[model samples]
Target: MAKSVAPGRPNQFLRNLNSKIACIPMMLTALVIFLGGTVWTVIYSFTNSKLLPRATFVGFDQYERLWAASRWIISIQNLAIYGVLCLIFSLLIGFVLAALMDQKIRFENTFRTIFLYPFALSFIVTGLVWQWVLNPEYGVQGVVRSLGWESFTFDPLYTPEIVIYGILIAGLWQGTGLVMCLMLAGLRGIDEDIWKAARVDGIPMWKTYIFIVIPMMRPVFITTLVLIASGIVKLYDLVVAQTSGGPGNASEVPAKYVYDYMFQAQNLGQGFAASTMMLLTVAIIVVPWAYLEFGGRKRV
Candidate 1:
């Protein structure tokens, strides 16, 4: 006995019915938790909530104060420097490592393990390790001085102007391995036939990679870019562990700023305002990419 379907109802809704049913809980969680929380945060950003949330709206005062604060300004500057360098170096170094690994070199597994081992460590561990490594008395500076290079100086943690760059070093070491693995996966997916064709055509290996293989890895690059960008935006733990935003707030970032305000300073509205701005920043990056990536495909 067949159960009759409703007239004019498409069967598409019933397709993968179990999968759809399974996804309902996830969808509802996203709607209720993420979307709802985002809306609540945005709403509170406009109010004068302090210690406790109050609905008393104060317009853009919180935002104005946030922008005007020197600490916030410095945090933004540090983030900008860290974000840009981290993106460029991570991609470049990762791709280079992936390319080297793709050469069928001897002991490839050993090399891959060595490169990727750091990523297994948490950021806190990475930060702490790097902090010691960069310590003036017993780190690189000390070791070099011990080797009789008495004038050599390489400490970055205590230096205010270069403190952010110190953080960048830890970030790169921990992150580059993951990026390399991702790029290697993309490289491995490339067809052997393409390489054969390029070789037969007398193309240089580098030129082939530059002109053909990289373009084919657009999806991988985009995914890597998004991952790195998100990490940069929400960066806090590394800074906290490495410098505690010290050397007088030189390594302070937006996430740290928000946390310090919301909890430490007991200023909910200011924290929410900063968080809203962070959301806006993410939206600005994501919306256009989403449109170009998906919308353009639909149009085609």
Candidate 2:
């Protein structure tokens, strides 16, 4: 006699396979977009292409020219400074705003809306406004001079050594709100009993937040960090709008540098090389954090 198979196992397997099959269209669409664009960029990077891409292969000549370019090196260094400053300021300000907002203050909803409104606006618009406000001849400098303070001077955008900080200030203004919203959601989700228990034990509010609340919000903190990291890698709009990488490319970022080569300079190969380098740099910095956050064991 022949052995019989289980009744539902085959049906369940068929169901699972059907479900995966149903998702194939979406998966293929994403794969096509991602892989197609990446392949195109890689192919262009290998050629001696200009305004319009040519079919001639130039090996590593573009990479060599990129390495020898001083502006490229300056742009990379500027990006490091801007990225670190933006991350630090955004995190600190966001944490403080979120903590304060969680105190059950009056008009909490209004305050929350006010703080979050900035995130709704595009970076290009924000950068333009910041440029006007920071311009020495017309902005803070003129305002201060009008107030009868001729000795006062604040010309960060024109000063090579300090221009990055000026850009950082604008970036922080726009980004901190997003971090606050994330942290606020995390704070609200926290167990109320923890706060009550700490209060009953005579623990100070600051101490409770510092020790209990912050530690419990690790996942949210990690999420915020990753969000900011991605923003740093793609930073371009603010730099363009505010300084236009001015004062002789003092405030240039890798993204803007890549754009210049790809479009303005008509050097597609170097642009792609820069893009690849940026992707590699971001992976190096972010992959370790991602692994620790997702794969590593939880700390007690």
Candidate 3:
């Protein structure tokens, strides 16, 4: 009693068949490698895996130990301080630079290249350069002292209290250029008519930007937020190249904690647990924002 397929209807399954077939390998790799690896890491995190992964399930002992460790606690605190400051300063400075660049200034290309040059260098290079620049005896402090001020103090890498800020400086210098470019592109995408209307309405330029332009660039802001947040989460190499978590683990971040525990300390379970916590933190921040941003949209 079932009706046959309609002659006028196109077969949905066969549509884009070649493209879908071509993507099978990539899909399989993502599923088997990334997803599978994540699952494996999460599973072994609950076990007492040391030296190598084992099946000695230890319930949340690894996590409890991780939390109780003073080093881990300091790292979390440092990450929070670093993340908040980095997000704020990077966005503010980048947007300001972008807004200035959008004013049709002379030698814009030269200025942009100069501003963005730091971004072209690797984080390791940036860290090394900043380390030298921030060195008390050999860099800024020395230069200022030689100019007649002997008591000028400017070392941060060796100072436990402000070591994270030293790394933050390097991070901002290396990252702000890219953020500026992204903001510039977003600003450029804004309609000129909007500006004209604002002018005709006697609205201040700053007011127009704050009230209208920024709201329109929501997608760009979201994209930049994701990039910056991801970078903040995996901040390791810069810390290693600059301070190596020195000055009594003051500059230690979550990623470096995970790495040291996994490789140096040979505590795989503890490392995995820390990593799982990082994943959970990212999920907690990202999931709700993503749902709010896209969940209400109707799928085509």
Best by lDDT: 1
TM-score of each: 0.96, 0.90, 0.95
lDDT of each: 0.95, 0.88, 0.93
> Model 3, 1-300: lDDT tens per residue?
114445676666678999999999999999999889989999999999998999999999999999999999999999999999999999999999999999999999998999899999999999999999998888899999999998888889889999999999999999999999999999999999999999999999999989999999988998999899999999999999999998888999999999999999999999999999999998999889888778857563
Model 3, runs deviating above 4 Å: 1-11
- lDDT per residue for candidate 2 within 1-300, as digits (tens), equals 123446554554456797889999989987898778877887778888888888799898888888799998999999899888888889889999999999899999898888888888888988998899999889999899999999999989989999989988888888899999999999999999999999999999999999999999998998999899889889999989999999888999999989999999888878998887887787798789677766686652
**TM-score: the better of candidates 2 and 3:** 3
Model 1 stretches with alpha carbons more than 4 Å out? 1-15
Residue 300 lDDT in candidate 3: 33
lDDT winner, 1 or 3: 1
In model 3, the worst 10-residue window by lDDT is 1-10
Stretch of 10 with least lDDT, candidate 1: 1-10
Task: Write one digit per residue (lDDT tens) for candidate 1, span 214-298.
Answer: 9999999999998899889989999999999999988899999999999999999999999999999889989998999988997
